[model samples]
Target: MPAPDLDLRLVRCFTTVAEHLHLGRAALALHTTQPALSRQISRLERQVGARLLDRSPRGTALTEAGRVFLPRALALLDSAAEAVAGARAVGRDRITVGYGVNLIVTPAVAELRRRHPGADVRARHVEWDRVRSSLLERRVDAVVARLPLDDDGLRVVVLREEPRALLVPTGHRLADRRSVTLDDVADEPMPRVPDERWNAFWRVDPRPGGGPAPDGPLVESAEDKAELVASGQAVAIVPGGEHLRRVRPGLVAVPLEGVEPSRVALATRAGERGPLVAEFRELAATHLVG
Candidate 1:
């Protein structure tokens, strides 16, 4: 005949009794009275349809069935504990926030932490190209990115509409002209937006040459771009916030007269956000915008 279906509770009782080899001690180990243990053992025997213990003058000895079943019983309990623990670990949530150079130290990010205390916020300084990909794959919950995205799958919350500024060397011809127009430095070599963005539309490339064809200086991080301009190495165009002026004293930020400005917006995957992701978007809107 095939073996009977196993009962987890019975397995626990059998393992406890076999470990102690005595009813009273096994009862204490299991935190139960001796009579309850005896009844449990009786129930298990009826279920398994076998004698599991040999009662004698000395104490209890395991029957052949009990000796074979002990290891299997213990194994079942171990598996259950592991499964429960694994499930509990998945319950702790972690959300990823995507941004580039300047947003890392911005007040928006700072307020995000302040509003949501101890929220698991993982900030990744990803390029524009990877930001949407990360959002699509659920690698990140939301992204604070530049506006006019080519992709239409995600939704956005406009944070600010800031003016575009000219990044020029301090001693350059128009660097100290109060504020230079796009026509003023129309002939200088342009620097390209360093971060590799998914869509070219969101990129703020170098306008030093004043024309297409990115043959000029390639700048990556915003702070580094400012340093290059300050040193008179290469000039670039930047947004107002991206030019965190404290560190770059030599660079002059002049508002460009003609070129259209860029809008900074928060991007997130479409549909309803979970509690954690929703909270981040709310806090960003409250503190990031004017």
Candidate 2:
């Protein structure tokens, strides 16, 4: 016959009783009356369909079945305690915030630290290819990512709308132009993002004529893509965030015409209402403009 499905309460009672081998002492340890503990052990014995204890003048002794079950019962109770402890350890003041270099608002990150003094607030610079994966895989607790993300069990808070621009080397043909249209570089090769989640968005696919884009290097990080552009090997349409403009001075960003503005947002797993994630979302709300 199959073993009975015992609940945690029963397992805990059995472990306590087995530990002391005295009903009165075990009841005292468990803060229950002696009679109550006896009933609980009796119930457990009925469920298992085995005589677990031998009662005599000397007190209770484990029968063969009880001896065999004692070790497993203790193990179950120990595991439960550890699981509870592990869950509480999540409050150990550590959380990782992931973001693309361009999507992060510098001031907002500082504010998050100020708000969580005791928290080990850390940053994880995520690449465009891994934005959604990082959050889903628990690599980071929260993230600042671009829009057009699928609503697949995630929550997104719109922080700002960034104007899109094309990055070209200072010496490139379109570099000196005041501003250029997508058509001006229709056939120009741009770096490729092989990750399906990121490829279409970064590629700015469906050119003005609804056609495929010319391929360039298959890249991961924004820094790598910028290198390709700076070396005159490729061009990329990027968010015109102030930080990007300041860091990549070697590349001139010409505002692109007829392109959708990129929505920069804070994203986290759905149903995860942790305080760290909430605080970051609130901070983004006040500090960002979309």
Candidate 3:
């Protein structure tokens, strides 16, 4: 028999209920009553041929089947949203550029806008770890990323290079230093970022002594790393730029020595020969100064 078509509405309802784990709260969040929400869940369960949630007077809990289906359901929702956005962008002279933290791309964006008055240029903030994936997944047409990025299938233009610095708590020993070397921080715990290449580059993994830096708390965002540093739980290496001058109150960035300077680059897919992408890449090369 052919598979049944799944309703996105039902999937959304189930995910919300899974998140809250309570019918009452889920109903409120979905803006529907408990009984109606229960009906929706029942309809979904009937279509899927499995019970997704176990309901009790006290609360609700996911059945084994629900746990397996949740992630796929979320992906479906994400793809649906991306599909809608892509459709809307069709026939429009639009381009979205992604940029990482502490990196600036505004000057290039403004120049692109000035040159192509009819072009719809937009900037999206890309998390440090998502730089490559954002372009590969078509989330952004191009990105301004800090390098040591794995550029296997991408065209990369080196914009500039800048020294890196270590972010430490104000009272830490290294915080008082004019500068420090890899050996100085060899034993210090560094924030654990998701991407291996990124983690290796930022943490200066496999130190001069030849092993990975001591692992600290796992960090997913700049804010997370900053908080961990402020609390003295971990230290992070970042671009030594003007943005560091306004770092969080409890943290300071000390110059890091004995390492290669970080490079800022504009990257797009290898297959992208679009004029807008080409133009923006040229503008970034010209206007993005370190």
Listed per model in order, the count of residue pairs whose N, CA or C atoms clash below 3 Å is 9, 1, 0
Clashing pairs in 3: none
TM-score between model 1 and native: 0.56
Q: What is the C-alpha lDDT profile of model 3 across 1-290, one tens digit per residue?
A: 99878988999999999999999999999999999999999999998889999999878999999999899889999999987887786556889999988777999999999999988899999987777788877789899988878788899888888888889999999888999888787778888877888877888887766877888888788898889999999888888874357677999999888888888888899988678888898888789964
> Which candidate number has the best lDDT?
3
Residue 218's C-alpha lDDT in candidate 2? 89
Using lDDT, rank the candidates from best to worst.
Answer: 3, 2, 1
For candidate 2, the 10 contiguous residues with the lowest summed lDDT are 240-249
* Model 3 alpha-carbon drift over 4 Å, by segment: 1-47, 51-71, 87-91, 242-244
As a whole number from 0 to 100, the lDDT of residue 158 in candidate 2 is: 83
Per-model C-alpha lDDT, please? 0.70, 0.78, 0.87
Q: Write the per-residue lDDT of candidate 1 for residues 133-172, one digit (tens) a residue.
A: 7676566677887766645688888888877777776777
Worst 10 residues of 1 by lDDT: 198-207
Q: Which candidate should be chosen as best, given TM-score against the real structure?
A: 3
Worst 10 residues of 3 by lDDT: 239-248
Displacement of the residue 209 alpha carbon in candidate 3, Å: 3.7
